[model samples]
Target: MARAPGFWFRQPGPWSAALAPLGAIYAAGTARRLSRGGRARVGVPVICVGNLNAGGTGKTPTVIALVQRLSDRGIRAHVVSRGHGGTEKGPLRVDPLRHAAARVGDEPRLMAAFGPVWVADDRVTGARAASDTGAQAVILDDGFQDPALAHDLSIVVVDAAKGWGNGRCLPAGPLREPVATGLARADMVLSIGGGHAQRQFAARWPALPVPHLTARLQPLKTGMDWTGLRALAFAGIGHPEKFFATLAREGVEIVRAEALADHQPFSPRLLTRLEGEARMLGAQLVTTEKDAARLPDDFRGKVLTLPARLRFDDPAELDRRLDALFD
Candidate 1:
């Protein structure tokens, strides 16, 4: 996938202005598709964790966090995803031990580590499969724009650092649909990380009645001491810089940082080059959990994965929302 246009993050530039007409067309199509709502409903409650932007807004992590919360409340929640970047296109269960990221997609494989996961281009099929398999609830990762399945609750996640990105749609900007349309349907707005973009978004849409929640990605302990360690950190994610920033906060001495496109496939030649570079700098290889999931089996032991969890600003508030959904 191509990197998001820089103009998306800035105010409407000449390029965004030039493409505004195309954006209007895309927005209109989305609105029309959403209006034809004959969504298939499953037996259990379905919660959608999605975003308005085309790029990552930490949806996978949010799904994992919500699934864990559901488990804590004794709710068997299964996750449904489109399995982007993978070859599979079916209503299939993700077996983390048996499936590779190349087949099931990185996010689904990572989510499978937390709970049962289903991969399907048709989300309605995926949700039905989850329910048939005894899931009490279903979590739809990146499915807010998908109207084929009914959702009991919709929570839109926004990267606080990259809010709305010029607020245009498709080829013109980063949005998948217009922000106002998304907000109108959203039950809650989850702002992840701390940044001015989120503040600006809030100020710009003060009349929105959705409950706003704040959360941060907290790195989990890897049991390996990171202090004073020279490391070559690499990431293939929506924002690789975020991973690098997290490593810096953990006090890991980054000898080098490499940013690859989101969901970039790791070939043997590329892994060899990265390993050589790490060896040259006398540094250990470290990467985010999502990237680590895509590594070939041979490279698995050589790379250290930095796992992260979502820490809500108000745990009670999150609990109440979840409780309301389940109850």
Candidate 2:
């Protein structure tokens, strides 16, 4: 299991101190590669929405938001993804209703609502599928680290709450690539949450030459009733705490809380264990939409899924950005 940022950042031992040098090396290599142009020559234009971190930074919702915006402008868009946890081979087009989460992965299923969504381990192949489906432009979800596809534009999504965590890579920190590296390649930096991290980034990285936008995490609904109800909350997201926090906000009485690694595939045995625990606690199982997508069909209906959306306060600005992408 990966150690939490609070766990490592609080440690002051020699081992923790020793890792800084290696981090410098990792950061340098990251910067070198990101400095290169991500020029693509595909028949259709490609826009990449990705992040510097390994885990979630609102990229999925951003993809959805962009798809919606593009559609409004008479631009027929499609999405291509790696299908992170789903068990599938070769390139496949996601038919939202027909394809369950187990087949095409959760994000693609969600993206399919806006436009054609295709998944493949081979991104180039997926792009081809999107093209065949009549997509004028393809949105590459989480492809910032993928250098194979030439992206016409790249947008870097950063979690305002966890701003590059200790600014290190892999085992030492949460960054998949260094911040400077991602910023150098990005056409824009989208900061989620109107917090100090976003403000600090603007002050310190003013020379990045990319436009910065502030966004926030919004609940899908105004409220949910959990009065006189016992609940067991579990999630396989970047931060399980965020899910728990949302439950708390909804007034859910969480009798038991469980967390799994990000993008964890659910097994019948695992769901059985959770169901047993829920019964013991006299509670119903509840989870995030992403986690619910990974559950087997037999157990899916038993799980309470809380769907979420990415709502921008000034949605017109985001729409304007998509218009700029095509222009």
Candidate 3:
């Protein structure tokens, strides 16, 4: 996806006010679509990890964390995705080895690393496929706005630091739907950030109607110490700035930070250019695990990967909801 306009996060200024009329139309269309009937339900429970904002707000990691939590309790969870950036058109299982991000999209490819994943434009079809394939429960990725499949639980994830950007919908701001409208359907709200960011979000939304959950991303242990490591970090995600921040927190000596478009294709030419830049700066190439899924065949092992996993501050409320799904 293209980088969101800067004004989306800013206060209601000329740009936002000028676009407000269009945003109202967009929000109305969303409401009409959501109100449509004939929503389907797969045999198994479907837990949708989605966001109110158009861009990412840690939804991928939230899905990963939920699947991990389900696994700990012996539930087989499968991920069903829309394959946003890929060319795939069917409800097919993703095999990380056989499928490239170019085919199945980066998010689905990365999620497949943890468990079974299905990619299809029609989310309802994908959810059904997951249920038929022994998925005790299915995690519908980024489909809160789509009303085709009825989700047992809906989670709206937000970057605590970037909460509801200007609180407007669509072209006027980052929101896909108005805050109040979306929250009315959401079973929970997850705000991902550090201690300070989390506290600030809570203070800002003290009356957030849904259960508010908080979490922070922590790098998964791979035995490769990141302390003082000299690196040229590049990230192609909805929020590359966050990835750079993660690197800084890990004690990486960032020689240069390159922010690429979300799911930016890694062609050979681009890879060579990035590699040359890293060599000239005497820094190793580093990237996020999501970007690593899109790396070319030869450069896959060469570039360093720092994979972060979401660790919820408290999962008691979350667990209670998950338990309710079975009961």
Estimate the Cα RMSD of every predicted model relative to the unseen true structure: 1.5, 3.1, 0.9
Q: Where is the poorest 10-residue window by lDDT in model 3?
A: 197-206
Which candidate model has the greater lDDT, 1 or 2?
1
TM-score of each: 0.96, 0.86, 0.98
Ten contiguous residues minimizing lDDT sum, candidate 2:
1-10
Candidate 1 weakest ten by summed lDDT: 194-203
Full-model lDDT for every candidate: 0.90, 0.76, 0.92
Model 2, position 184: C-alpha lDDT score: 76
Give the candidate order by descending lDDT.
3, 1, 2
Model 1, C-alpha of 195: deviation from truth (Å): 6.3
The pairs that clash in candidate 3 are none
Q: State residue 171's C-alpha deviation in candidate 2, in Å.
A: 2.8
Distance from true location, Cα of 269 in model 2, Å: 2.1
2 versus 3: better TM-score goes to: 3
Q: Native-vs-model 3 lDDT?
A: 0.92
